[model samples]
Target: MKDFELDGWDDEEASTDAATSLTRTAARVEEERQALTEQALAERITAAVNAARPGVDKIPDPVDPAGTGNLTADEQERLDACVAGIELLSTATWVAGKSLDTVATGRLFRKLVHKLEPERCYTTIEEWAEIEHGISRSRCSQLRDGWQIGEVLNARGYKAPEGQVRELVPFFNRHGLKAAVGVYEMVVQAIGADKVTAKRLRETVKLFPGDLALSDEDDVNVIAQSLAGAIEGATPPAPKPSTALPTELKREVDRRSVALADRLDRGRIPRNEVLTHLLAAFADERDSRVFDVVFERMKTSNS
Candidate 1:
């Protein structure tokens, strides 16, 4: 009887060991599988990020014999250093513009301007940029404004192309960061992110009242939906002689018309008083005619 009991105990022990071994093997396989999956996911994310990055031209080596004529050892070294410094600055500026890294670009501009000032190489960043780097004064201003706009957008977890961000600078300056960010977010939500262009942003921004105050709690989607509805319902006005107004003047009228309509909708201006105010304000015949044309178009759409 004792021998029979020992044989049964041994059989049970062997079965348990086999089960434990199988569990260990299964756990090991699962861990390996999970590791590989995670690695693949990381690789895919890296690839996507790389694909989205803008291409930059490779900087050539200044010291390469193929690119430089024969020179003394010291001359070659000095020339190499000078060329490298210029290339570094130029490359950094180009990358900043492409990557929308405006803050870095602005800082680099300041440093270069200061360095050149004492050496009498250039008196101002604008001069240095134009003469040395071939960047225009307008372009320099755009980059500087981009830095300010970028700060606001980055704080709000948004990214835009430098051109798009530059377009927002005027609105940002007038309405403040919160309002600018709200408009940006609304535009992005309305149009797919990839489809946003400077022209599109400019047009959308013109729809908002310059004085309209937006708070953090404001639902940007509400604005976006309203604008979308207005746009969808709007019909192209029949071209009139007044439509020949200068492009700038026409844009101003469009902005005013939109603002007036928004005010009317929000009850900021009494319905009864709208016409009185509008007529009194439009003393100039040309201004009145343009406003009349634009306002009528706006009224038709809203109605």
Candidate 2:
């Protein structure tokens, strides 16, 4: 009987040890599986972020705070241009409470950076021309796709991502899109101090919504002047004679009366002259005739 009891106890001990070993093995396998899953997820996220190739996410520190600057020669030139633009358009009010030069440099730097890093950026020049500048939509579309034009546009701002510049320029050039770079300077210089001209330009030629959203009349004027300066070399439309002069041609009419209020800060323009040129380009004979009546009245008031 003692022998039988010893054998039975050994069998029971064997069964308990086997069950414990199985549980331990199962726990180890689960841990390995979980580690593999975590590693895979981490790798995918890293790959996605790496693909984005972003620049600095935060606003950069200003180069100066007192409006007096310690910028490099090129940077100083850019600042001077920005300053000239602000002063010329009577937009000095917007230059208040901040370092205009520093702000200008920072913005310019960002533009350069964005142009250099085209993978994550977009160009608005073509869109600006199409929506606001009276450049036909088809022309704008062609410009975007035309290789040389695109090159000129980009080169106006920056060199392409490494050697990519060479290819882009050729493509843009071949497609009849060769652009003279740095036209932004011209834009600021044109239409200086003609505030009313600025507002009309914004209404008629503003291609980008973001640019047009500026509420300050002076600021809008300054920007309009800048754009006009860029394209001052462009062809001006011819004036056409109108047949039927309406009663609104007299001084008392209300429509386009606000046109007379356009100021030097608005983008210093020869208001009637520009209106006439633009009307000739944009309006039908009948519409231009209607414009003549209001224009005659505005001329009388300013006279």
Candidate 3:
């Protein structure tokens, strides 16, 4: 009986050891599977990130086509450095126009011009630019003006295209940077930044005029808000085949016509003062004709 019990006990112990070994093998397999999954996930993420990145076109070396090999070593080195500097300035100019970093580009232009002294190779900065880049001095001046305007706007956490900002330089000079910035903010708030084109800004400046008390911040805000309200509430004028009466003038004419009809019903003609004001309001020749046509029809019908 003792020998039989010993054999049974050995068999049970062997069964337990086999089960434990199987569990260890299963755990190892699961761990390997998890590691493979994580590695695949990482690779997919890397590929997605790379795919989303913007592609940069390689800039060709500007000095490559110059045939500088025939020149002396020192001359070639100087030319290479000058060309590189000019290339940097050109790149910065483009980036500044796009990114609204005009101030930095303007400063870099002056610094590069002084450092490279294009006069050594060409007669003037303008000459070098015209010959190599086809950029005019007037354009350069406009960029510089854009930079000045950018300085004011950037300080207030605002941005505009170089062309749009250039339109405001005169306003800045007349009303000061603070007033200009106020106007810019107001216009942007009213029409949106994208709609603040050079033409639009120029019109706003003309409408507001330089003689107004734009220096006062409160007054500026009030004017800006008034303009903003007008912009927001005004209806887009319908397309007209011929030169149509201005919308505001049309509204005025309608209101006055009703009032004039009431006065005539009471057997009274419009006062001389009233007629004078009406004539004054119809400033445009085409608008005056429209007014004349409407009143003539009114007279013919009433008589």
Candidate 4:
């Protein structure tokens, strides 16, 4: 009787434990179902926000969907700003200080207006390229000739020399810029590529010999100042643009002054090429005669 009574108690205990386990499992399943339902609702909310926002590409998918990340008011502003036109233009990283020439300004304004119109929401890379190429012609040629010019241009991205922001200029125009290539390469060439090799340019620009692929800004600035001195004939050993060609070739400049003087010595730099780089880096035929006379005098003095 005692053994049978013990078996009966054991059976009851086992039945109670099993019942408790089943109840817990059911509770867990219901909890999971509710969680999933909440997740679906949150996703719907996110989708609605993204749909209403005009130009944004992504919605923040918080890791804990239910845990509203307790974003501060400022953070919420940023998030909400992502839904408006002000946000779209504010977030645009480039074009801050880029110059807008007569033609370029029109294109930019038109695009900006179109973008702000709410219904129009996209820009093709091709159209951007066309604008880039239209105003920036030598950018293409610099890529072809001077290895450094393109490097500097790309490194600077849309940033210009003033460090405010880079402006757009057409290639081959030579409006007022001091270079044949885009402005960035002009700086690198004006200084030393080693001193001015901006990492930003390196990534986008094609690398070249003495390309200044890894230099700091301060060093480049000093070197550029020195180069300006040399070019102006103020503080150089001399303007040996061949050695100076980094400064010259860096910008893919015509280097007519260097070439003209060089051809005068070797008779290789045709008058046309001289006129091309330095119409003033050279002189007229009368000046040429005086140069010849001075050359003979120097020879006689040395003899």
Clashes of 1: 0
Question: Candidate 2 has what TM-score?
Answer: 0.22
Please list the residue runs of candidate 1 whose C-alpha ends up more than 4 Å from where it truly belongs after superposition.
1-122, 151-159, 215-303
What lDDT, from 0 to 1, does candidate 4 have?
0.44
**What does the lDDT read for residue 210 in candidate 4?**
26
Writing each residue's lDDT as its tens digit, candidate 1 over 152-221 gives 5555555565667767788778766555666677777877776878898898776664335444455655
Best candidate (score: TM-score): 1
What is the C-alpha lDDT profile of model 4 across 162-197, one tens digit per residue? 211122123113222223233345455645444543
Task: List the candidate 4 regions with Cα displacement exceeding 4 Å.
Answer: 1-13, 20-24, 27-30, 33-37, 44-48, 55-87, 90-164, 168-303
lDDT of each prediction vs. the true structure?
0.63, 0.42, 0.62, 0.44
State candidate 3's TM-score: 0.35
User: Per-residue lDDT of 8-122 in model 2, one digit per residue for the tens?
Assistant: 5577789899999999999999999999999999999998887543333322334554346576776667566555443332221212212323433344333332434555432
- Would you estimate the TM-scores of all the predictions? 0.37, 0.22, 0.35, 0.23
Candidate 1 lDDT: 0.63
Pitting candidate 3 against candidate 4, the one with the higher TM-score is: 3
Error of 4 at 294 (Å): 30
Pairs of residues clashing in candidate 3: none
Q: Give the per-residue Cα lDDT of candidate 1 at 118.
A: 67
- Per-residue alpha-carbon lDDT of model 3 for 1-303, expressed as tens digits? 555445456777899999999999999999999999999999999999886443332223445444635876755776666655544453354354444234334533343443245554453545545555666777655654455456556655555656667677787777676666667888888788767777888877666632355434565566567555555555655565875678897677667766887976854344455657666766656567757777799999999
Worst 10 residues of 1 by lDDT: 53-62
